[model samples]
Target: MRVTADLDLCQGHQMCQVEAPAVFGTDPDTDQVVVLDEHPDPALRPQVDAAVKYCPAMALAVTD
Candidate 1:
């Protein structure tokens, strides 16, 4: 699976990072959501999905 983020829509909430630290992160300066692993292992799909779902800004997406 692949993870993508819309930085413009990100609100620095960091929920994505909290949900899936292995696949998502936040920029220290901007505090925006960052995709740590654009292409994460299938084993991490559940985490990735949770991250996307919990993102308040709705900036995260998954493509499989």
Candidate 2:
């Protein structure tokens, strides 16, 4: 699966980082959500899903 974040929609709430720090991070320069892993290991799907769900901006997208 592939994961991506829309910077335009993102407000740096950091919920994704909280939910799945392995796959998401904050850009210190911009305070925006960054996708650490575009394509993640299958085992990480659940956490990735949680991050997506918890994102208030709904800026994260998962493509399988």
Candidate 3:
């Protein structure tokens, strides 16, 4: 699976980072959502999906 985040759509809520720190984080300067990995392991897909679901701004997307 692949994950992507629209920086423009992000409100810096940090839910994704909170849910999966290994795959997501916030820029220290801009505080925008940063995708640490686009193609994560299958084992991590669920967490990624959860992050996407929890994004209030709908900035996250997953493609499998």
Best-matching candidate per TM-score: 2
Compose the digit string of candidate 1's lDDT tens values, residues 1-64. 7789999899999988878899888789998877878999999888889998998988888987
Error (Å) of candidate 2 at residue 23 is 0.4
TM-score of 2: 0.97
Ranking by TM-score: 2, 3, 1
In terms of lDDT, the poorest run of 10 residues in model 1 is 25-34
Weakest 10 consecutive residues of candidate 3 by summed lDDT: 40-49
Tell me which residue pairs clash in candidate 3.
Answer: none
Off by over 4 Å in 2: none
Clashes of 1: 0
* lDDT (Cα, tens digit) per residue for candidate 2, span 1-64: 9999999999989999998999999999999999998998999999999999999999999999
| Reference-based TM-score of each model | 0.94, 0.97, 0.95
Q: Which stretches of candidate 1 lie over 4 Å from their true place?
A: none
Candidate 3 ranges beyond 4 A from true positions: none
